[model samples]
Target: MRSRNSRLGTAAALAGLIAGTAMAGCSTTGMDASDTITIALAANPTGAFDPYRNREFGISEVAPFTHDSLLYKTPEGEFVSRLAATWKADNTSATFTLTPGITCADGSALTAKDVAAAINFASDAANASWAYGYYTPTAPLTAVGDDASRTVRVTVAQPYGYLLDTVGLLPILCAAGVKDPDSLANRSNGTGPYVVSAVSTGETIELKRRDDYAWGPDGTTVADAPATVVFRQIADETTAANLLLSGDVNIANVSGPNSDRVRAAGLDSADAYTAAAWLNFNQREGRATSDRRVREALVHALDFKEVIAVSTNTHGVAAEGLLVTEPAVCPTNAVAGVLPGQDLERAAKLLDEAGWVLGSDGKRVKDGVPLTLGLRYWTDRSELERPTAELLAARWKAIGVGIEPIGENVGGLVKTLYQTGNFDVYLLGWDLRLGSQFIPYLSGPLPPRGQNFMALDNPEYVKLSAEANATTPPQGCDLWGKAERAVVNDFDLVPISNRVTSLFYRGVTGQLTPVEPTSLRATQ
Candidate 1:
């Protein structure tokens, strides 16, 4: 193992790659000198523009362009105001005052009604927004207008001090655009600087700037935005890179390792270690994984370095704790990372301790049954799951643990097996954008609560997770440290590594900072 001080050095050295082949066959004619900024989405939103009910896709990128969220995150990951200028909270209630003169693309003024409608939509049972999980505010939204004033007021049903930050990214919707209150999905009524021009399934989506728009915490003016932005859904990574390198598109969101190829091809790239690649354990299943000792053994059996090598470049930050990075909470005594390599001796010890012994086929037999598990990967076969799962299975097999590679219809079977806790083991990922609830992946699925599909129930971890979520920013650093330590000590779950979001840009487009995509300043 490399010394702790050399972790980053090792990561950088491991990022080298041989010459790559470009795959995107886009037209190079108009794209070479075009003013339009085209972005290639790695994966399109699952369906529609709703964030609540859908578990994956749609909200993050689309919302930012078509709707002005309450709070926005700069590419650097800092939060800034969008619709609500400033907010305050007391012991029992939190309130947000709207910024004046903000208008929808249709020229309708943004008001308290828009804010209320948006939140109500998410909080409503019918909407089923996955974004709702991050919102801690349970208060029924009460919209009020000061009789003698044009400013509006928003109060929670209960005291939720962190409501503003929790609902920070909720997009305010124009009431006029919402024709029915009962419908869970709708699109294009947002008060952002841009308006949706068209959305085509499995192809491309487009947005047009609102010439009269003027509002962003930074006082950004969209009066001069490009006529339109076309987001093409290009699933192939090599193809996307080829387009950027060949000057067929203005930007492409490629992987970290490929960033080198883009530059080698005479283009530029920008990247941020945004999220991490992780394996989620379906706890509902009762098998070798049902035991903590077995889980720890499996974690120790797989070499994370190899996983990172095959997965992507950047060695993606190796995460020992749940909250992939800082500002995301961790326990006070959290270890920097979990076990990194296969310790056959340790794996055997853990297996022996759990009363499992090797059988004739070289697989462990516990209670008259071979410790074999059925593992499933997404059939879309896109993500790094295929190789990661194969590597994991191979390591476990060497340690007398049998892992059965199950090929099934992608989404449905995987979800069914996990939710019902019927499979021996399953692999998946949980997005960490909901920073504070780092432990919910484990806690939410515990029995009775029923969300803890993993069925991992520990009083201490639950307490630590709750404390972390309830913590305020002033105590953020300290609280996170405490939470991280607790999670690492339990060894209840294994965290792989953090992921970086890569944006590929072709030739020059003015003097925009690579860190900032598309626009120069909020005002630009």
Candidate 2:
């Protein structure tokens, strides 16, 4: 399988984006008085800052400063104008009228043609843009720009539900960036409130506020925005927290045990939930997990409540569905009772009925082959994953099942799951904001051909998802809910837990709903 990072947001990225640690009694002593905000990134960004390509959570958090979307979704779930002054959309087509006077950092005007070109580049399947699946539907699409009227129109082949939300939010590239493309690999070019002033490779990315920029959500300007925004790469969470406490850094995310200290210290914080962990089985023909009975037996072997607690370091809630991020387009409870509760006897019975018998060594054997499943997990949260894996292994072992834990980094995990297809079960997190986003991962072609890494083929899920996609939101919500439920009920994937990532800030104030750099301003 040709590998591509899954479109869903990974847990490590979410945790790193806003993560920090805390030390009691520490005061903001060395606070900088300049009009600059220093934000700590959990790790250095891997790829380019191209909004159409890089979807890394860390990059997404900072990209807004350099690249402006046509429309912005407010914390209140309302769509507000940014680069686009007005917009309207139907199920498959949308039009956006650009806000006049917007200019790129290079002193060139941002025209309708530039915006349309960005949409076209990102929508083309041959370009392999990450935004292809997340922001736009995989189906063929076209964009036309009427420079005379300052309007850009997009039309999809299928009836996509999120035409406005997805297409409207696509980051527009300037004429220069689109023409060259290669120039945006390490640098940036767009019509936003800030410009990339300097890049120190993996160490730091510095952005300077644009003085003439007047376009922002609801007509907000950069009058109060910091003059310079610095994204400092700090791989260690505790170190990031210490920097926040000392006033060396203004913003950082707090997770794990350190989050409690930050809460106790009464530091200002904003919380957002993301997919922390989930279980997905490889259902290729010969895999043991391909059998529904085995999948159900494994799910029924352990208490999810305890698993959530242990896996999230006691800082998570039971997942309601795949859409855990804030402002989910369809916030329906699709996972309430879809999964079976912990029942050891039922698990054992199901395993036995699947033709797996317990042997002398207390291991399940089917046709003389031991039932040892390869359980893969990302090692970014080894502190929590190790214990969670042990807890799961202990429970499954009691049911005469053996588990071989395989730990890998994010890149390695993607390789094994999407490329090699060597694992049986894998645990990971997903940060998704729309119901339609799950369709590609749930029912599309498998691997190299598509992103359905688990090779799932659920007729009901496929049917419901297609119906849901044929209509617009609110109108399609019911179908989307039923579609997600089908995936859960069939054990295609299990929603393990969702963690609340808190962004702690000191000497700064802004919108926490998303922590937009344009919205942030120095308090000291």
Candidate 3:
């Protein structure tokens, strides 16, 4: 999970010369070992591996090996310190006490400066990090000092709960030596147990264990340490499961639909509730989806039960909120009455009530304009998106709506379409940590000053989302449930299905399957 910047470096000859010489000093003799483990991710990483590292695919692979955050969530969804030994927070600011004697891979002692630098990098508009949701939450963070007494200070615009959980995952870097933010953003330069040495994006990421590393959750250094960790990108679940079965890889993230196949092949299965598949509607002109009523009608047409059956083989749960299955955000009671099941009769009634009529072409029309919509699905050449889009298009077409399933790279397409305001519908996935992380989608069009693409402006939702952030877990659950019910009643955003990630491993023991609520620290 090393960033592309780490492998690609700079195009200049100066960087080339430095990289060539640095490559000579870096060795991989321990990478190929009988005790070493290899895992496969579903997609290629989108660079940016620092806490500022926004990509989920990269975080899934790299977070376990190279990055150490201030706090990590336990299997029970409780927060514990990782880089910082402890932290104290008040109404305005949070003060952190760094774990003593921490050093980066190159042997430079880690300090408050590195942590501050990583936060600064993530907050930088130029870096475009997805991590700003926690670190720069309408506040400025300042690092206080160096030395063993290194305490960092973070000032908030307003008091909010779950701030610790949000900031806990920001990775610490050696800020003193890092002159290039891009290099640090893309490369492995942290105080974790392992340091990435060689990376071939979409192929393999190689990490070497740090002998001097002594920090761990069990109050001692790891004893049974592997010399190296190799992570490969295997987008195809069947292929990845086969590799794990054949002993090519030690573990692989199998798709929910393919979990039974892996179990049948005699490999162990560990289920992780990480993300969900949801549809994004573009608020733009020349699209039938320009009207909110029309969008609501379209959502009403989707049968989440059928989606779970046909798409996931009943391996996943239907989503009740924008953020799937996280109890703190979309509590057990909140999700119970919110799933969007099929109601074709109700859907037709809504469309007709909205003044859209069945036209000669069998498509819905309003004011002599046919209801034509553009639906872009991920064209990764993998079966993940295309098949789902085909199913969705078929359902929509039957409802007198012209739905076109276009193939495109969904990541960039989402950003591009959002900004251009030219498309109608798109499919995307979101991974929000339990509690406050789910607030962003409800607020919409994040990055603060940016667009809230859905054009959904509800004073009530905004207040409830903030309250959900300001309150503690169980209490927050109650407040968030009310907010979730309000949003569903308004038909703001469509909740598709809660995705279940299945991991197949050969030598792992115990219940690796995660408990209710989701976080990567749980699995490790």
Candidate 4:
């Protein structure tokens, strides 16, 4: 499933990299070695800690610390063993051999039966897991485990590409956590390097390192990891930066103006293209954006280059496609010439042909109704979202289009998009890693039924995506590229810009993975 806070969660993955210069000669020094690491979350977590159920950005931000998957995907895109020491897959089936001596946080031996149960639970549609559509194949599948052989086998009836990539990310729960799922609402029971020690609801989540964790990626253990890692909720970017500089926090994601401040403070930082911020028009019936002409016109109404500068504070690049994460499954540019460039004249002409006549008061009118559109955006996602909304509103207004910029927090925005469906347009970023993850958001039943929040019904995209999903990667990359082009050429969503999320770190050193900190060692 597309994380509810994909934009923020994915960006936070790169937020753990510590610079060597900033941490020089500080290895195991000033701060308590056991209490040295502190991370910042953009917002308070409101969902359960259940990896399969909670897709909140805050939940995802801390997932790597609390959960362990079957395998780990390195920043280089190589799949390494975590719980499963060896794994092999075909188009329709996959087998994983669990590592010996792997145990749960509760000290119970992690057997193949536990792994199979987690898979069966997540893959079952009856459980209504969002992971079913995004992480697992939509087709029927079965998982069986043999404890004696320490093997768990998964088989599908139809050809399903990305079988390994999908299952690799499934955070395997212990037998207890799987049996009493409700107990995982605020606690964790995984074999990861950390365990949830304390939670103050929306304020903070404290994790203590698990010294027994020895089956990490590449056999890394918690030997050098901080004894305690705290994720504190600090909403303001400037505040987060200040805390990092003051040594109140060891890691924080600083974007916009504050990023420069953190950099000047001698903090070591790394940037990742975490998400693609874009404009998604609600294409349900009766919406003005339902007309292809209107969608194209609106896309042509603004200079995206300028929008990118304003929205990202000059730290973003023009988006190439929907997949922004590095080492994308399909490394093809599907958006080069597919989307229309800025053309005010063309926009006006299209709007005119669509029956939105320019009015005397400088607004479009069609059939006695004013052409006003509600442009919704998340207020707290970035310091730039508001200005970006204002910029788009100003540009669209110049073309006789009335835009009402509506600001909401992440929760409010999700409710409006998925449940209320009250807005005409939405401006947000989707932090996605795979091409298949885009299908549920781009097509399928609308909110309360499925996650197709935009209500898009592109027949071409639907057809191409189906063909692409049936084939494995490398072989399916061509079909995936065509499917992405179909979405872009049709202007289903305007790819605005790709933000470079700069994560600032201080007084810490460790292996920096694309998604989170692994084998972290506190230097200060």
* Backbone clashes in model 3, listed as residue pairs: 50-53
User: Model 2 residue 481 lDDT?
Assistant: 90
Error of 1 at 14 (Å): 26
Candidate 3 residue 287 Cα shift, in angstroms, is 4.8
* RMSD per model, one decimal: 6.8, 4.9, 6.9, 4.5
Candidate 4: TM-score?
Answer: 0.92
lDDT of each: 0.53, 0.74, 0.56, 0.76
Model 3 residue runs over 4 Å out of place are: 1-35, 53-60, 120-127, 134-148, 176-179, 218-220, 274-277, 284-287, 322-335, 338-341, 353-355, 367-369, 378-384, 407-422, 444-455, 508-524
Residue range 437-479, candidate 3, lDDT tens digits: 5444455553334335555555677787777766666667777
TM-score of each: 0.78, 0.89, 0.81, 0.92
Candidate 4 lDDT over 315-366, as tens digits, reads 7788887786656788667779888789999999999999999988999999
For lDDT, the strongest prediction is: 4
Q: What are the per-residue Cα lDDT tens digits for candidate 2 across 307-338?
A: 98987788878888777666778877878978
Best prediction by TM-score: 4
Ten-residue segment with the worst summed lDDT in candidate 3?
Answer: 7-16
Candidate number with the higher lDDT (1 or 4): 4
Per-residue accuracy of model 1 over 1-524 as CA lDDT, tens digit each: 11110001001000000001121234434532322445565444534453344433322355556666676555344666667676665434455666778777657777676666666666543443444445534335554544234334556654434555566656665666454433324246667766666666545666666777667656667544555555665556677677666665565555555666776776655544433335545544445676778777777777777766555454366654444322332223244544436687888899989989987778898789878777764423234546667877888899998787654432343265434455655554333433453443456534223235566666776665555455455555565566555554555555666555455565434322222222521211
